[model samples]
Target: MSARRLTLLVAGAFCLGACSSLNPFSSSNTKIPALKPLTAVAKTAEVWRGRVGSAGRFVFQPAVFGDAVFAAAADGTVVKLQAGRNVWKSSVDMPISGGVGSNGRLVVVGSPKGDVLALDAESGKMKWRVSVNAEILAAPVVSDGMVVVRSADSRLFGLDPADGKRRWVYQRALPALSLRSSAGVVQEGNAVFAGFPGGKLVAVNAINGSLMWEGAVAVPRGATELERIADITSLPVLGSRAACAVAYQGRIACFDLANGSTLWARDMSSSRGLDQDGRHVFVTDEKGSVHALDLSTGSSAWKQDQLAGRGAGRPRVVREYVVVGDVEGYIHVLRKDDGSLVGRLRAESSPILADIQLSGGDVVVQTQDGSVYALGVQ
Candidate 1:
């Protein structure tokens, strides 16, 4: 098969049904209360993993297209893997982070330089490249032929996915909040939903970048709290009818997508990442703790510190487990009901910047070494 066609097939055909619909609130529930801590040396193993066998760290995690995985490393190399086989490899100058976008094409953010490039999904051939206003640290999101990117200068750009042409750019109205979190954009139908530096979540018409609605999320309640808090680092997670933004000052909040109204909010701290099972929303904090909150009422159903260490937690809920990857590269899969450690898988030896993918009866991870691994129950 031609490499381009293979890449396209992998992007569109693989077991991405689990990723396409991220509504955790609607998933089936089988609760298991938290279990006792494990003193036993966790029996963990990697089922099948692939890498370039090169010595370089991958700052960006791999993006999955069906069974295929794509990632770029600090050394400016891009590798594609299917199952456990290294299918193809390519390189660009100083490609620090960024991965394949929604369409399975590799998207690269040129580091120490301000450039963004798109490559053919299968062949690793350059398709297009564009220069932005500043360095890009976060990943880009593609929806409806539009590529929305966030740059270090606290600006958002909407580009035509066909040719990397700039469509519109929106600079933050307030001081450029050091945007460690990537800019998130989701298109439900006609509205483009996105979050900004000042904790404001806004929706713009997809065609013209016209403002539809805007609401501040995760903001300090008053002056008393303002002295203690900072920006929203967690990416905004979209659900069936709502979207959520968790903040650093310990707040878990959700907003209505249609009008940007506050649906629910709670103080949660140093929030890192979020996932939902369609009924319950799961959030992880910097302190290596996870909390399950009622999606509709904003009530806490359960909370536990499943991992405790420096850079130990950023909970990811997939299927039946609360999956967390620590700074040391050990991924712990805990029972979601109460918080029991179901399995532990060491996917990498260095810190992981990529999120976990639960798809097609497998747990997929792309490590900092630019390696992609899949663990499944046989």
Candidate 2:
């Protein structure tokens, strides 16, 4: 299953971004790497299981807020699960695309027709609906005062949380070729960090929608458009003093949080995404190998290639382990000190596209079929 896709939305010999990825990693020629027998150093136990409608081609991740897990499906079902049981299930009355963004009070999602639907978190009732006039592929982020929605046309809208009214809009020139990713933005404090095509990461003021600073996570290179298809396809991972991101056919880097300056960088490529913890940045490359990089210097601390050729999503850090889900629906836990497989558990048979989230100490992930699973690491 293709996690994300390349929509020329292309003018050259095929498109870029994932087109650069699409060519080399096409499923026809790619084979799932065999998993070697692993001695389970840790144990993963299923805490609970919940179900939602199948996502179809859209990406829907389960959002955890306290004990509540909000998840949606492509078929217009938005279900809020508490303890893996439905607290409330509502319908948007339209096919959904991007979603499951919540900041406790407001649960927000996007419709296929570009409508941004804000629902009350407690009751799962519709609060407000506004259209961005473009299809929403990535989830719309919501908070108490502000809501940031990324439209398919590469525009970000800052909306009023009270009602889905536009506060401000931030639009950028998109590259000719790019990957249409379900990856969204990260909002921390007053800044909203978003990665874009051409491998640029920008910090926008959440209050006023002003550009705080821009950092080049990766600059497009290569002679052909496909080779030049460097785009950041995931959310920027935030650390204490730095914000780091990865770009396909590009690099993995950390930028200074204050000024958006590149703190450290190394040649890397990953459409999947990454996580930052302690002194290391963990990323899954395009071909599905996971690596740990030194946070301060971008040095490669270790690499785990056992899962190569298996589609892996962004990693989530829990305690001393890194947990990731793959296309084959196997959750692999790696030792943080060294990239060794520590534990493995099977969740389903479908592909897991969404990021592995954390619910307290348990790991949570929603597969392509919209089955939400919570695993306790012991």
- Model 2 misplaced stretches (Cα beyond 4 Å): 1-29
- Deviation from native of the Cα of residue 355 in model 1, angstroms: 1.8
Under the 3 Å rule for N, CA and C atoms, how many clashes does model 1 have? 14
Q: Taking the tens digit of each residue's C-alpha lDDT, what string does model 2 give over 1-378?
A: 332233443432453333534333233555678899989999898999999889997778888999999999999899989878988999989999998899999999998789999899999889999989988988878877899999876799999999888999998987767776778899999999999999999999999999999999898998886678788889899999999999988998899999998898889988889999879999999888999999999988999988888777788899999998888899999999998999999978888888888999998888888898799997
lDDT of each: 0.63, 0.87
lDDT of 1 by residue, 201-318 (tens): 7777766667888777756444532333345655667788778877665467788866778888877665467888788888876565778888898898887764643354456666
Candidate number of the best lDDT: 2
TM-scores for all predictions: 0.80, 0.94
- Give per-residue lDDT, candidate 1, residue 236: 69
Model 2: lDDT of residue 359 = 92
Among the numbered candidates, top TM-score falls to 2
Q: What is the lDDT of candidate 2?
A: 0.87
